[model samples]
Structures are given as C-alpha cells and as structure tokens.
Target: MSLFLGTHQNRLDVKGRVSVPASFRSALRKEQTKENHSLIFRPSHKMPCIEVWPLSIFSELTNSLDSLNLFSEEHDDIATTLYAEAWPIDPDREGRILLPDILKEHANLTDSVTFMGLGTIFQIWEPIAAIERCKAARHKVQQKTLAVPPKATKKGVEL
Candidate 1:
C-alpha cells in the first residue's frame, strides 16, 4: 500500500481549487483505479480537516459496515456519517481538485491549506489550525507519562 507522508501546503484559488502535492498524487496513482484522476473528499470526523481518499480505499473503508446489523441505528448513524459527507472528485491535468464550498466551510479553510499525511489517508487542514493541532498534540504527549508496551518477538511477546 502506498502511504501518504510529510506535510505539504498549497494555496486555494478563488475558484476553490488547490493543487495536490506531487508525492501524494504519485501515491494515489498507485491505487490503479479505472479512472486515474478519480478521488473523494470528505470532512474528517475528528479534526477540522478534509480527508482525501482514492475511490478504491473509500470502497474498502465502507466494507466495515458489513459487520454491523443492517437494521440497527448504529449502522444507520455510521452510514450517514460516512456517506453523507463524501463527495466524488476528479483532479484536473494540473493535479488540482476543487474544494467544494460545503467541505471548505466545514474545515474552516482559508487562503492556504495544509495536507497532513496520515499513512493510508491524508488530511487537508487550514494552516493555522494544523499548527495549533500539532502544538496541542505535542503538549498532550508531554503531559502524559505513558507506559511502554512490550514488543512482540517473531515467535512470541518480548518485554
């Protein structure tokens, strides 16, 4: 699997289009979808950021719903949460995707956006908010004294 890594910042144009990082585009291309430029944009459930997922990954992500009882409220809630916010997108030849007004508003996006790589996924954040989130994450780590877990050996657990 191609993992998205590093931080990239891009300018949002008047028409709400932003260029995806070259590295990210390369990573996404490796997914080998039928439509090369196809992508999906959705507001992140956690932070004030938009998430970019290739169609293949997005389809696989929805597979988890299979384990849920079809008639349950929990299933309905999760479905609504995921499907309701999803928007299909296609990057133009310049490797730019249009940030729809709804998602842009949800992420509180400004003139510039920060793409924070999260391994199998990536997030688009407002530059200031991304910086603030980083600071808070670091502070949270420093505030906690975490106990390290035992490492797993090839044959068994290791302390």
Candidate 2:
C-alpha cells in the first residue's frame, strides 16, 4: 500500500508556486523513480480544502467513478464539476508546483497554506480555515465517541 505521509505548513510565493514539503517530495520520489508524477488540483465539493492527488491515484479514482451510471443526474453533476475543475500540474526542479489562480482563490489560499496528507490524496487549506476545520472534526469525533463507548475486545485488544 502506498501511504502518503507528511504535514507541513508552507507559504505560497507571489508567483503562486509553493514547495511540496520535503517529506511529501520524498514520498513522491519513492513512488516515481524517473517518470514524472503529475499533480492535479481541483475544488473539493465536500469541504473548503483543495483536493490534490497524484495522476496515478487520480486515474484510479476516476476509473472507479466511471463504473457509476453516467446518465444519472447525480453522477453527471459530480463528473462535470470535479473533472472539469481538475488542473494537471508538474512540480518544478525545486519541487514546487504552481497552484492555479482559480484553485487558489477557491480554496481561499493567500500567503500561507497548510498541506495535509490523507493517504491517497492531500488537501491545501488556508491556515485559519484549516485549524478551525480540524478542530471541528476533532469535536465531532469526541461527541460520537462519548455517545457510544468502545466495546471490550478479545485478548484485551482496543482501538
């Protein structure tokens, strides 16, 4: 399994290029030896974060979505919005990718940004927005946990 790891806050230069955190670059390097891996940035419908995925992962995700009924309104809407917004990007020699102005505006990214790794995909978020979003997520998890305590497990295993 290819696990994406790295969470570093970085600044986007005036030209819209941002360094892909050392850890993330190393992970990408390990995944693609010589061939260049393209990065795709698209607006995330479900959140304020910008969706970013490697071209390989992007293809895999799209293929899975392709199995859905394309004629259905829901599927058509999803496909039109997500696919149309995706922008393919290649990191420069300095391991920085130029974020499209539109994507940056959609994600509310300005001077500073937060890069969060999510296994197969990552998200770019404005600093304040990212902090608030994470806090809300943590609170939601806590509420759910309190509502239903974990059951005892065999061999005393717990999660």
Each prediction's whole-model lDDT (CA): 0.87, 0.83
Cα error, candidate 1, residue 66 (Å) = 1.0
Candidate 1 lDDT, tens digit per residue, 1-159? 799998999999988899999999999888766755467789988888899887777878899899999999999999998999899898898999898899999999979999989888889999999899888977887889554456746326454
Model 2 lDDT tens row, 1-159: 366665679998988899988877777777764564788889898887798888878877788677789799978887887799899888889998898888888889989999888887889999899889888977998988755456756347774
Runs in model 1 deviating more than 4 A are 35-37, 145-159
Predicted candidate 2, C-alpha RMSD: 5.1
Give the Cα error of residue 54 in candidate 1, in Å: 1.9
The Cα error of candidate 2 at residue 112, in Å, is 0.7
Error of 2 at 143 (Å): 1.0
Clashes, model 1? 0
Candidate 2 clashing pairs, residues 3+ apart or interchain: none
Q: Listing every candidate in turn, what is its Cα RMSD in Å to the true structure after a full C-alpha superposition?
A: 3.7, 5.1
Predicted model with the maximum lDDT:
1
